[model samples]
Target: MGGFFGAALKRDCVEDVFFGTDYHSHLGTRRGGMAFYSPENGFQRGIHSIENSPFRTKFEKELAGMSGNIGIGCISDTDPQPILLRSKLGRIAVCNIGIINNAEELCNEFYDSRLASFETMTSSKVNSSAIIGALIAQKDSFAEGIRYAQERVEGTMSLLILTEDGIIAARDKFGRLPIVIGESEDGYCVSFESFAFQKLGYKTRRELLPAEIVRITADKIEVLGEGNPDALRICTFLWTYYGYPNSVYEGVTVETMRTRNGEIMAEYDIQNGTLPDVDYVCGVPDSGVPHAIGYANRSGIPFARPFIKYTPTWPRSFMPQSQEMRNKVAKMKLIPVHELIEGKKLLFVDDSIVRGTQMRETVEFLYENGAKEVHMRSACPPIMFGCKYLNFSRSTSELDLIARRIIHEYEGEEGVKYIREYSDSKTERGKRLRDEICRRLKLTSLEFQFLDGTVKAVGLPECKLCTYCWSGKQD
Candidate 1:
């Protein structure tokens, strides 16, 4: 839900950090921040709300004044960070990406009742990044503090700490997220997305192992600590949806994997004789387009864009303060072509259907434009469970998901026991589930990619990928 970039370069690195952090705008839309340390300026830090504007526009004015050879920046969906803190380790700036589900538990155990206190947000909840900083300061050294913080935080934690001399980068304990290093002629860099650095003339160095902690300076990267490599469980959803088209994680490119996923879906549909006879194969805008392209390529169907999203002025559809405003913005962004929809049978491939509200509205819009038929395909399997390892906002509660809501409608609370069966397309429950969704959304047809197919599309062993949102497997 958030991403970070850090630079320890030979020259004043503010410009590189600015552009590098801007590249991660696709990963988050809430807050943007940067922290730098110069002997002349000390730690120059800036944080701003980017809810209504792009990260670049919000930070452009300050970029010219802030100068430092060592700096870090972040695009976050949660609390403002690269927050400055003073502790036993000295004055430092800290920023983190990932959730801390057990913040209260950790505070109760370690935080001194009378002496220790936290800065709270409007909701009175301590900012997760600040909590992480507090936890890290509790230890004697950066390496030990990072290890302690990773162990104590129940959810996920991948962070960057800005020091006067260098930056400390730590990957998630289970490698659920990513921390990659890049090499340039001047120095080195660290980023969540590899492409962020590649564009800035930084060559791929190496990705940090699970729980790997390293100190990155202008000349070299020093390894501080590392956990077991076999504990890798990278989030598989990145390839299907959240990750940028150009981003690569664990040797797999997001766009390529998505295309492969679509091809696999088409292959299975043809074998089952479920491939719809449509005039064109289309995709929901943005992330869904690649999957649709692959489907079209494999099914021998022509790919067409029936509608285009107008994004020059509009922010992300989900950026609005309220759900009603967000839904309206989503529809407002689409400029439909009547010729593509009128009297045509169209099949659409969407990255994945989580809540189903937008997809339902999309189907209705097509029919209103005189679509003869509309069939839908989800590139990934049904999300049977909400994610637990990160600060993911797509589905907060189990009931927030449409699939879970439907299961409850039919079988009540006991439906929880058969979640696996409901996700299985060949099962009776799964068939009923699809039929019900179609009836509600008024779709001519609907099919979700199977679990095995998703894994195959990623080209990674199932054990290495985290399909927790679909399979609900903790390990």
Candidate 2:
């Protein structure tokens, strides 16, 4: 979903904050903001709509006029943030990264108690950061307020608060997201991505524990609270899809995991004697490229770039509001090589098949360019439920997922009971589900990575990971 970066430096920290936050640009597409605190100028903050432009281009000119040594910034998919608030906790600027399922209820509770009211956004929705700030303000100290907010929110929340002294960083209660600290001679930095601070000449200090809270300054890092190690449930999709290639979380790099996952998938196919007869193996561009390389290396197949993403004009496809528009942009970005696709049996690896609409369109595009047969391999299992911990998808209903829709068609209301069976490709229900998806998308064949294979690829114990989207088991 979203990412944040904060720096507490002995010298001017604006430059570090600017670039550190820019490193997280790929995480969110809606709003970008930065707030700085200095004794000379007080808190100087800027928020911009990055729906059309990148973070650097939008904030470059404004950086020259602003300066501070302690700051916090974020790239948000939800509300505009780095919301400045003056409460009993003092003048602190806060930015949040997480969803709040009980936002409306919380807002009503505040309203009924006459404690506070929130500023609404374009959709008349209360800004989550503001609500969080109010919740934090209810307590006596920053640590207490943070714990109070963490205890009340149903969904995940990891935040950074900027004060005159330094910045306070808090990871989510369940460790659903990550917050890492980096150290340098000048000061300390906190970020959602480890690589963000690494690029700023800072060494990796350590990642904050689940539900841990810390206060950072130019000289020292003080732990305000410790998290529960046994309650960790980090989102597994971060490695499979959302995380940046250079970034590492839970000691696992995203690109490395993807490559391993692809290798595992290929190994399974080879063992089962189901390796496809294909002229070339290709990825779905960008994120899927590394996975395909691993597959090619394992299977002794040639990896080719049959199509390249034309990002000169349309940098991000998700920036568009409507699904139809997004789909159009996605098609327009792919510049296919007819020489490779013409009269060739091509196998493609994608991160995951969500709604299947875009994958179907991509397959049709290949056929239009004279592809003989197209086989699809999904790097992860089919998503059976919507993500509750993060704002990963825009689907409002479970039926919005293609797998759920198919399950509904096959078994009506009773199909929900067989989600595990449908996820297991070896089972009869799973085989039928795969066949229907392939038939609908006009693909020659389809295969998805197994849950065990995915866990093995991640190099983590199954109990430590969150597989709710695939298994619907929150605990």
Candidate 3:
């Protein structure tokens, strides 16, 4: 995954551009880049290979002597972005977030046509920069080109383009990703994540609609096109894993949704008679931290980071391809802080447990440090079905993980047939399924966020989100 930030300002926007882009460091670990357009200089692009370090430290030297009235930046997991392209329309810098599912087919068609040539970077299938360039080259007008691109692309995209005249922001047609605008005295800012506006004193403007395109300059802002008001397909997984705590994608804060999820989980526990009175609440580091905070606030318990992250060795959250290496790295990254765990009945809040291998190690670590009993709470229910839309490459096969292990033991040879039932929230079968899962994991108790609670917490109607991972439903 990657994130982008762009701004058009009255004053030089280099500092704002630099720091705003730096705030999206956690989204991707491979590359950090920025492109600026100044009155004097046409367009300047800066990229830093940040595989081993933070974006701030890696791009600090690149910040010197780089100034522009309008600029765009990206933290790329796959390819370098803010690619400067010279086309029929003119030179424009482009940055995009989201995956293109039909990339191979499109790339093959383009190659066969002999009308366009793609240059620069390739990973997985089609290169991101090349795809954006191809999209831009497909039409006569910048707006029309991007519109066609949004229409033709199979997957999600949230893009920002900086030209000599102004900057344009466009969201994907299905709205699988998020894009929001911010404003300050200097100018208007557009970012994939709202956290970019934190220290810059930029106030929140309205979020861009799915497939909407808008142009921004220092003195003017215009909507080139508005998104379809009734489009019903926004990615629901954003609430569970992708979004920042301070960020609100569709009018719901991640923190608030997480709190509601915890409450729902607690309710499920009450109905099932599995609620345990623990000394305190704790979370696995990073993403789980926010959910744990929400749980503690709701349950009136102290929230602690008993398992503190050793980020120096394990800087990135999403691991590289090797499974054996990733498992080892996950344990090394979280060293147990025994001070919080010693002789305490702790409840651990986590986003979700896909493969319980790493979590089992974590629980053992807690016991070794003198934890009397450890209870587990997950924000969302068990991921019974494998995610088909996004590149959820962490757990390769569903059968190799915890969900499958429990399901198989409970339903015998025909367990896979009952995956949909296990994911359902209201059904008595779903409740029993969760209990069996808890027993298998050797937890004091376990509960999952109800499907209704998750949808309500996200603030989007149930129709918009992709609950395929849980319910096996697809749009």
Candidate 4:
């Protein structure tokens, strides 16, 4: 859960690099960084903490100062990226998107071989810089270096290297993360998410094929080597959880799909006669806000933000593992506006209901603030399955909540029958089950983000996305 954007431009690319990377601020809050190469400057790197500050504010001073033709930048969730490294290969700057699961083993291997010592950050992992540097040191060529890094890592990684000669963009072999190329009058841009491209007046050149590596210079963008195209595995969770609405992956637009999801939820509300007489419809926060906008537009209601996010504190989307800490953090991060909620029957849309503990507390706080009634709508169905691919980072278990407990009671056994109801949101039994679950959550009403609606919301053909978290399907 971090994102990066890099570019090799025909003209000075400092503005594109800074703003493109800033577009990914929603992805990570720990650190923001940028590095660039110029014949005179060699490699320049800048890092800032966005925890108490925003990327724009923190990097304002560096924007004009860090000018170059080729550069790389990152919004890092775990550690600062765009790490400038001096190795036998060359002086290079590295940035990554996606996680490396085998950091410990690789770190130890580097240490045992007396190759390098990694710098530890607040997160306690071997610096991603050191890991990428180790890979660079192991190979003779940039392509080989990336291939070595992709082949050895367990999880996903889409990376960019700004070397003394040129820039290299590489995606993980599985392509569990996304990387795309953009072309402008200036030069070429490489990024993990496409949202950055549109704002910069750049058009997508092409998506970097899975396990593909390409090196770019002022003259041309060249494919270095192919990792493995047939290993066409992409993470399924991007649609449901982490990705932004404007970003595109696998030829699908996130905003269109989420809007479709909103339309479907509106229809379902009408069919069930659960539509409430609400003054305004609002989303829980950011993720839920898009769908709420669609819902309000379709349902002909005002879309309001009853609770303003306390961004100063609760800015990060996913937190480190700790329930007590997360709960406290969540509470401190949101402030309810009594003026909006008081005497109003509010319909609130959210991305998903995980454990529902945080949500329950949130709703109760709304009521205490004088909300006449609070109706709940979820963009996606209940998460009966814990994500196997993602760190999830929020809740550890699928069964640690009301949905799983109710399913257990209904089946009296955790077997095929119980699992089937949880997946089928349209089944009469499924409807009854969700109704009961909603009653328990103390929501006046609740509607799951349907599987079809979710697919449409993601704007992807059925074959591209991994719906395993919702349907219990495994690839």
Candidate 5:
């Protein structure tokens, strides 16, 4: 997953575009790019790797030569973008924030038809944004081309394009990702996160519906096409884990929803007589704090920080490319508080236990520091399948997930038929799954927020949300 921002302003929009794109740094870590268009300079673009440094630090040097009234920028985990392309639609700077699963097939089709050829990157793959441009060029106008490109792409795609006239913004077809407009004194800006613009002294204009397309100028936002709200399937992970605390999507704030989710989980535990006796209720840092706070408030357990993540050296969302390094760095970031962990019965609420690598390390570290018992609460249900839409889980295979691994061990290929049962604690199979995970992780107890409970916490009709990672169902 990634994010982008664009500004068409009365004055030079360099600063606005720079900070707005930088505000989305949490979305990706691979590459950062920006493209600007001015009457004098025409179009100027820059792309740099952000694996070692942050978005702001890496892009700040380019600010001297970059200036424009209209610009588009993005933070991407895959290919470099805000790519400068000249086509029938004109020279437009484009960048995308979603996955395109069928790239190879589409590229092969393009090659076979002899319509056009594609340029591959260092990874020996075509840039997704470039492929989008090719698809859009197949039609006559930008609106029709946009609709066409979206229909062809197998996965999610939300994009920002910088043209001489202004900027064109389009949300993904199924609305798996969100795009919002913000109004300021100078002009309007577009972003995936509402907070990104609000912090830039811009007022909330409106959020684009699923598959909507719009063109933004300094004064007005013209709707190029309307979106279908009936087919809405916005990603649920945005609320539970990926989204920033201040971020809001589908009219619900992330922090508010997380707090509410924890409250709902506590209510369920209380009703089921499963609320554990713990000396302290602790959150697994960062995203988990709000959930833990809500759990603590509802269950009347004293909330404490038994261990803190040393984020100064390693940013909360900063990820290394390799899994081996990720596990090593994750362990190095924890700084335990002996006063809080010594002889304490700790119950930790985490955003989600995907691979359970970090959680296992954390629980083991606590026991080493003298904790009597370590219980765990996952804010979301066990992920049954790799995310097909947003690629949020980053799992190359289902075996990469701890839940899937357990299912494979017990039932082999037969486990695929009972994913729902394995996800539910009420089922005997689900109970067995929990016991096995607890034993492996060296935990005293374990529980996950049920699928229905999570939807209830989100306060959205089930038909409108995407729970593919957990339920293996699409809207």
Candidate 6:
């Protein structure tokens, strides 16, 4: 849901940190922050709200006055971060990328023990970065403190800590997110997205293992603690939606995985004789394009762009807080091509259908534009649970998901027992769910990628992947 970039260089690294952090603008829309440490100026930090503007536009002026060889920056979807703190471990700036599910409990524990007190934000919520800082300061050393925090946190926590010596980069305990290191002649850099540093003349050095902690200096890196390589359960949504197309994680490129996933979906449709007779195969745009391309290639259907995204003025559709505003923005970004949609039988592939509101509107828009029959395909299995580890969805309750809502309506509270069956398209419950969704969305037909198919598309061991959102299985 968020991303971070850090740099330790022999020379001034302000520009590197600025552009590097800007590359992660797609990760978060709420906040952007940067903190740099210099011998003369100590730590110069700046945090800005990016809800109304882009990260680059908000931080451009501050970059001119900031200069440091060691620095860290982040794009946060929640609380403002790169929080500067003074602790027993000395002054350090911290930024984290994961949610703390048990934050209230931890805060209560801190209050009960008289260990720490938190400052409330405008929304009356505690700043997670401050809590993380307090947690890190509990132990005698930074390394021990980080480990303690990781062990105590219930959910994911991958972080970057900037100290006077250098920067400390730690991947989450379960490796739900990615933290990669890159090398260059001037120094080394760390980033959540691999492509961020590659543009700055840095080659792939290595990725931090799950729970691994490493310190980065200008010319060297020291391993503070090793990670449990066997305990990886990286979130599968990265390749499906969150990750940049050019980025590679665990040696798998996002675009490559998406294309393969589409191919697999197409192959399945063909084998089952479910391939529809359509004039064109189209994607929802942006993230959905690659999947549609693969499907078109595998099925020998021409890939067409029925609607183009106009991004020059509008931000991401999901960036807004209000559902109504988001829907409006989503509609404004898509400019329909009448030539492609008029009297055409089109099949549309989307990354995934969450609440299905936008998708329903999209199908209706196609029909209004003279689409003859609109068939829909989901690139992944139905999302059965709202993600607990990442801020991928804005839905706060399980009922916010269309699949969960449908299940509830069918079997009331007892449908939970048949979740696995419902995920299988061959099962009666799954078939009913699909038909219900199709009727509601006014689609001619709908099909979702099988769970096993998605796993195969990622090309990772099933044990090493997190399929909690689809399967509701956490191991």
lDDT per residue for candidate 4 within 1-475, as digits (tens), equals 7888888887888888899999988788678999998887678889988766788888888777777799988998767788878788877888786667788889988889998887787667677767977877899888778788877877667788888767888887766778888888877888888879888988888887788999987667899986565565566456555788777888877666566677778877778776778999998777788778878887888889889878655575345346777777776677888799889999998888877877887788888888888888888866777655444444455567567767877776644366666656667768776788677767887778777777666665556556656677665
Clashing pairs in 5: none
C-alpha lDDT of all candidate models, in order: 0.91, 0.92, 0.78, 0.77, 0.90, 0.93
lDDT by residue (tens digit), candidate 2, 255-293: 999999999999999999989999999999778888888
TM-score of each: 0.98, 0.99, 0.90, 0.84, 0.99, 0.99
Backbone collision tally, model 5: 0
Q: How accurate is candidate 2 locally (lDDT)?
A: 0.92
RMSD of each: 1.1, 0.8, 2.9, 3.7, 0.9, 0.7
TM-score, structure 3 vs. true:
0.90
C-alpha positional error of residue 25 in candidate 3 after TM-score superposition, expressed in Å: 1.3
- Whole-model lDDT, model 5: 0.90
Residue pairs with clashing backbones, model 4: 257-457, 258-457
User: Where is model 2 poorest over a 10-residue stretch in terms of lDDT?
Assistant: 312-321
- The backbone clash count of each candidate, in order, is 0, 0, 0, 2, 0, 0
Winner by TM-score between candidate 5 and candidate 4: 5
C-alpha lDDT of residue 7 in model 1:
98
Candidate 1's residue-wise lDDT over 199-268, tens digit each?
8999999999889999999998999996668989999998999899989999999999989998999999
How many pairs in model 2 have backbone atoms within 3 A of each other, for residues 3 or more apart or on separate chains, i.e. clashes? 0
Q: In candidate 3, what are the lDDT values of residues 113-144, reduced to their tens digit?
A: 88666764544555676787687688998789
TM-score of 2: 0.99
Prediction 3 global C-alpha lDDT:
0.78
